[model samples]
Target: MTNSAPDVPATPEQLRRSIADRTWTSPTAGILDGYQQANLVVVPASAATEFAEYCRANPSVCPLLASSAPGDPQLTYDGCIVDVRTMVPRYRVWQNGRLAEEPFDLTPRWREDSVAFALGCSHTLDGPLRRAGIPVAVTAPPVYITSLTTRGTTRFDGAVAVSMRPVEDDLVDTAIAVTAMLPTGHGAPVHIGDPAEIGLADLASPDFGVFPGIGPNQTPVFWNCGVTPQLALAEAGLEYAATHYPGHMLVLDTVVAA
Candidate 1:
């Protein structure tokens, strides 16, 4: 369920401070318009190299933006200072391939051998899709795990994750065109029409976020999602791993150029 809180943060800095202050512990969707958002992933030094390669092998789903040196909580998005420990609204701690806790901060869990990665989110292209007359809503898009699996890297293996957006039939082409312009943002629709063709059994029941309905004359569009890495981490079963809670993401100072 979406947070029902009033006065949602409106600017990138305001949203970052709200998260840092622990005042808003909800998904970052619909928060700062135009600025890019990212999926967060922190892993131990031992698993960092393999994970980085995993991202490279699966660029469409995990377009890496920046990565930090081991033991560093500071990310490398030039021109902006972002503290990975607390700038994201919510974080999911993982242990032995399972979710351990959803915390507002990761200071207690940071490790000297930890390395953080910032991956581009499809949300970065929502503005262009909207301006192009495709109604890409700001609310969380429904994500589903497909039978498809990544070309397994050293220790990473799992099904692919795809987020779905229902587009009016007439605008589906426009949605594809606009989203394709942003290569870093999971460019283009991987699947356009049937959910079953992609192994999505039901639309109402999703692996993450609220299920969006497919209205008459609308088709459900699917895109590779940054959440794909979370699945790989689970399969890798590292002693410890951390990621942004699905839907909750790190708001960035960068913008997706039109």
Candidate 2:
């Protein structure tokens, strides 16, 4: 599932340009190795208050990175500039509790009252995980809708989503230790070993992304995923909303993890 490229941009800005110019439209996993990537979610100004609270209530799954002012596409944090309308490689437009379309650009759908939110991405820990000898899928890792729901109000209450990565039995501790230091990147594993413990029926079928190959002596490790908010947004029955395509995250100019 690797988005293999011999000329992958080396810097965050360069990578963003590649995405902006449509040179790279794949998942951001394993790209801009040390930088923090983010999940994009845009909602109308009317829903911003509840959505912000939802993120605060579910910090592990919806860690807020940068939120744009209504009608403004610019989001700057840690010296990085994210143009919400074009930074993401893919976007999912939601309407009335359903996904309306998956588009590469948001210009046509952008609204004057839209507020874009950047949620911390789990891909921020991929480098640390790999450095610790834990294998992360090259493409977007598999995500699941957990039975757990956020402590949000009626407008934002929905299932908690988690991303899965298979870790060797021996390196589970190492993976946990390494990712624990990255609070912005969903931190440590919320569940380990049994998938059914968290209501996951099969690892082969995921709510998003491709199923990772788990070898012998390896067990599935789960982390809070930024996609949690998207599920909530769908349940909220908003008139219109948008989010990054699973794994097509916004690479930022910040080192979130070692």
Candidate 3:
């Protein structure tokens, strides 16, 4: 059974509309349940092949979803016509290794050779956990950073950053069982102990989002997050690329075709 939270709408149309209009540019993690969410990377076609190769070499971290052919904003192969320019809640456009706040659209800087890539995301795991009666704690969406360094595919290099969730110790096993079946969702826990073990010096200070302390005896489990790709982008110093603002995913009807 899937989770049936009252606030989780039967359809994500409302949420998607809000995002497209730029009215709701916040995180989309908990707004919709069961739907697949993806991280995005839109870059020039000059880098698409190498990036595709990189994705192939590193499937656990950067699981690819859909991609539009060159110059196409329509991700139609998956029948999900995301407006690459505005469908996402927010965009992070980078130039020559520096990061900017958020770009509502990439019209001005849209590369003629640009292509987009979607990666599988961790939010896909939360639904089943909630249904299983596992207590998955979150102030909103758990934006987290992993302490492990991803095996970089060339210029991409950085520690994997993951969202944190406080799982009750007893439900940890069930949560693992539930998530393992979703192979595209980074599989299962990458680490399950003190944040310090993953080089996370403290739980209070995450690379993103608010961090509430782990409850008494609750365990901190980590996963091979999709944000791994964004970190890789940041590390590579790619002159032109855009990623969805962390936690602000593309809630698509398309499942992870991986």
Global lDDT of each candidate? 0.86, 0.86, 0.71
lDDT of 1 at 215: 95
> What TM-score number comes out for model 3?
0.87
Worst 10 residues of 2 by lDDT: 1-10
- Least accurate 10 contiguous residues by lDDT in model 1: 1-10
- Per-residue lDDT of candidate 3, residues 96-132 (tens digit): 6678657665566567778988887788777767878
Clashes of 3: 6
Pairs that collide, model 2: none
| Order of candidate numbers by TM-score, starting with the best | 1, 2, 3
TM-scores vs. true structure, each candidate: 0.95, 0.94, 0.87
Candidate 1: segments with Cα more than 4 A from true spot = 1-6
Candidate 3 runs further than 4 Å off: 1-10, 137-147, 255-258
Off by over 4 Å in 2: 1-6
Q: Residue-pair clashes per candidate, as listed?
A: 0, 0, 6
Against the true structure, what is every candidate's RMSD? 1.9, 2.2, 4.7
TM-score of 1: 0.95
